[model samples]
Target: MTLTLTQTAAEAVKQIVARVPQAEDGGVRIRDTGAPSGFELSVAPDPEPQDTIVVTDGARVFLDEVAAASLEDRILDAELAQDGSVRFALGSQV
Candidate 1:
């Protein structure tokens, strides 16, 4: 199983990565923070050697080892606030 991203989420990620000039070839990276959500999102110019890369609609998302396992059966969704903030949510893949 592998982590998946909704089209909305992909677009959101694409938008984020577009803002980072250095991350042109990069995208959004999801890491295991071991916190409440046990996850964090950031712009990564490149992926770690062990990272799991998932690309959807030309949007690339890098999932760290722990995050990859944790989200393998999950789907990532996103919502953009009026202020241009991105809110990400994880849901079971159906």
Candidate 2:
């Protein structure tokens, strides 16, 4: 499975990770929530046994088996809204 992050997203994640206390040994985890058919992202101390690790330029993203498959051909992107809030976008690899 493959998961990618845009330059903007990578930069944003890197900045957030840097501020985390144990970021050096931890990474971000992305999980699929079957109930509502959505995903959740958070910082994790480490990847779980069944996680699929995606290493980007400046950050590491850990995805569980289901999440990895769900995002196999997707790209994670970040954008700044008019209100100055950060928004996350998921797109097809094409």
Best candidate according to lDDT: 1
Best by TM-score: 1
Superposition error at 26 for model 1 (Å): 0.2
What does candidate 1's lDDT look like per residue over 36-62, in tens digits?
957888999999999999999999999
Residue 38's lDDT within candidate 2 is 90
Candidate 2, residue 47: Cα displacement in angstroms equals 0.7
Model 2 agreement with the true structure over 1-94: per-residue lDDT tens digits: 4989888887767666666888666777899987575998888878999999888885788999889999998999998566645677899988
lDDT of 1: 0.92
List of clashing residue pairs for candidate 1: none
lDDT of each: 0.92, 0.82
Candidate 1, poorest ten consecutive residues by summed lDDT: 33-42
The alpha-carbon deviation from the true structure for residue 78 of candidate 2, after best TM-score superposition, in angstroms, is 0.8
